[model samples]
Target chain A: MSLLNNIYNQLRISHKYVNRLFKERSCYISTSPIMRDLMEFFDDKKNWGATEVKTGRSWTKDDLRIKSNTDLHKLWYVLLKEKNMLYTMEHEHNDQVRLFPSPERLDKVLDSMENLEEVVRERNRAYYELETTEIGEQTHKTITGPFGLEIDYYETEHSIPKEVNAQWQKEQNTKCRPEDVKSFLLKYKEKEYLQNKKQQRRNFNHVIGLLNRFPKMDMEALKEQYPDVDIEKAKASRKYKPPLVFD
Target chain B: MRLTQILYTKIGEWSKKYANLPDRYIKRAMEQVYWRNPKGIQYRPNTVVKRKKFHFTLDRPWSAQFAETNSPGRLHPKVFVEPIKKWSFFRGDRVEVLVGKDKEKQGIVKYIVQERNWILVEGLNCKLTKLDRGGVKIYIQEEQPLLVTDQVALVDPSDLKSTGFEWRYTQSGEQVRVSLRTGRIIPVPASAEETRDYKAKGLYVEQPKDTSEKDLGEVTFEPTLKTFEMEIMDQMGIKEDRIPKKSYWY
Candidate 1:
């Protein structure tokens, strides 16, 4: 049996209800006045040919937090509507080859929605922590990627162990090659070395240039700009000769 | 009741005058048409008529000619509840964008295109739109405000001052630590000499040379929260339309 499948089975044995809750919430669709408003996220049939549509701002984190859960639910629809409107506008814009005005509005809404979800999750965590000892059960598993980097995989309680089950195991393990690894490591090191060397040379050159340009360089400003460089040694260098000759 | 009786009498008289036509049907059509297509009369164009008609001869070149500029202009019909003259919002009222990067960005609405649902805010970001076939279009819109609710700063009524005031970070205003949007506390200097030093060095770098150069621009001097109060107000466009004296800052 795969380790992840085993973990999922174990989790299912304990917190089966929470998993159900997540599934239910994810699938649940609201059809209310607020939801109707949020459905505005979709473009109208009449405006299908239009390349652009005007819209207001996304709901702020502060705005969402202050509202009661009921209000939040309603506002969710509002935001959802705005998202649909933006999507429709974006789709039309792309189709007609026009610039969608305030494209950042989409990102803002997405950010706001994400933050709202995070806040809800935080509340849910607190509630679960109060009732149950754990912050619910975080489905976490560590696995090496194709590049040999370790990543955590969240586990959920399921009927069967993933690794033991052929289908789940296929989903878990991804394909990787030894030659690709060697090449990746080589290129990664080379890139790292280049970046460091470039930064070092830039700093060294800047120090030399500063000393050359401003012979009586402000001690504080110069030191602040290049903290690692030995300012005294840079000043003493022949390259540090100022444009004005000393009388 | 008395007004209804008079209308019936008038209708009866009109029916006898034009006896051949159906009086009730004609009255109903007139009322329905009046109810449906009532448009406010505002601007009108005058037409001139020529007393004599002129004739022109056509050349028999045997060439077919087709009119190309026959595409109808596009328009979205919308009814305005109020007239433009009645709208109090003026061109000079400064609009300050209340969000990041463009926060406190102030501009005046140069022209209000009521029919088009557009306002030309001077100095705000404007874009020239190019159509697929040809020609360019211009559009102006307001910056969206930051979505926030609980992060609103609460001020104590007793501590209100003309120069300096107290602000709490949390919604409840019970917490001691305050978080500024700029991610730093308002600096308060110790003396007049320190104040001058702070202003000279404390000036935020408008544009840093590079990411590494940010640390170099950090000012050693600190100014009091009082000195920085006006800067916030000036940047926020509060001098024109003062923030409510009692309302909480969101």
Candidate 2:
């Protein structure tokens, strides 16, 4: 599907002429048969020094879901090769201190690859759910770490069972001071609280300034916009005091 | 997070490139093995002490992510099979072998050839070989000539005839296979236990029609396509035993 993307078309040509052209010129055209392999890695020769290269959006999960397994598997390898080529070119360009052409090409390929995996994962989950009563997503758990803090750890397959594994046991059994960890967590929470408090103050002060500048300010809208800000307090602030004026 | 994933993916590509390095970049890659996890703390690879070992990192590169639990079954690395796209049929399903030595033979689906478009029917076709070695007779049973996807069709449970299958949800929001020919709500063997209690109690509601959820665009693989290594595999006569590796354009 990526192969036919963005090729120049002659839609303006009459159907009869288009048919004749295809028949005479050979329907299949290998523009760069000589550099077929190189085409995988590099963009067109014309785009060697071009500023930008435009491409289509990434493959969506729904789009990939519709593809047969064989097709998805085939496209995966194609995309994988494209990614490798893109990486090689970008690495070379970086080494030579040149701009990697439209770096988002790399992004687009990666996005497609990701979406492909997501689609595959969805299929796997559905299949597993039907065949077995479980969604076959990679499972993880929040376990207490060495620091006495809960950390998300992925469970992996082990050659030796956990009951008999010595190496894993050593990693799991680490000495931790609960007091130290509690202090550390408290400090972390305090930092977060202080940052949030500062933001709230800033928003409140900004609201006061706005109300002062505009006497006919929509108080209800302002209250809705900044729920954290005490609108009544902002209105009572000296900056927001109504200016006395002779009529 | 997205940028990190892209960079990590590039590192994976670099790992692959290490195999055919220009001898100039191997040293650069050896100096640092880039690895990271989305949520975990970042750290440099400080455990390495060699250069040659750096190659084949793509196969088993150092992963900083919390290790995954061991997978129970695996399609061989050489054999990258697609995950089952739909639950149209299953192992216990009674399928008719449409083409083979036992053509038109109806039998229960013994096992599915994972990743490959084939299935083995129970006790249908078997190749038996008797070998006498070291004064001992060995009987080897092999199930060959698997039923290809095109050559076989699913047999409906009601009439024991081939039929197209559709998906429909039960009253309890359970997905079930519906036999198109009979309009019989194929008991979701997995989810709802096809219980008389649910049906007798008037709890089961059949969906009006099996709606086509989405356009699953068509995708096809050139079955004949083979790489240079596959040709070698073919020469070795292990080609049939091995899945063909797809070409990686470089």
True contacts kept of each: 0.00, 0.08
What is the Å distance of residue A25 in model 2 from its true position? 33
Q: Candidate 1: which stretches are off by over 4 Å?
A: A1-58, A137-146, A150-158, A162-187, A210-247, B1-250
Residues A1-247, candidate 1, lDDT per residue (tens digit)?
6999999998887688887787687556555434444445555555555443333234445544544444445556666766777788788788878766545457656766776776555555665666675675464767565565555555665555554567666765555688887787788779879977776665666678756655544466556545667877776777777688585
**Which candidate number has the best TM-score?**
2
DockQ scores for all predicted structures: 0.00, 0.03
Give candidate 1's error at residue A212 in angstroms: 4.1
Indicate the residue-level lDDT of B230 in model 1.
43
lDDT per residue, candidate 1, B43-113, as tens digits? 11132221111110111011111011111232223221111112222234344444345544555544433
Model 2, CA-based lDDT: 0.55
Number of clashes recorded per candidate: 22, 9
Per-residue CA lDDT of model 2 for B204-229, tens digit only, reads 33322112334234543232334323
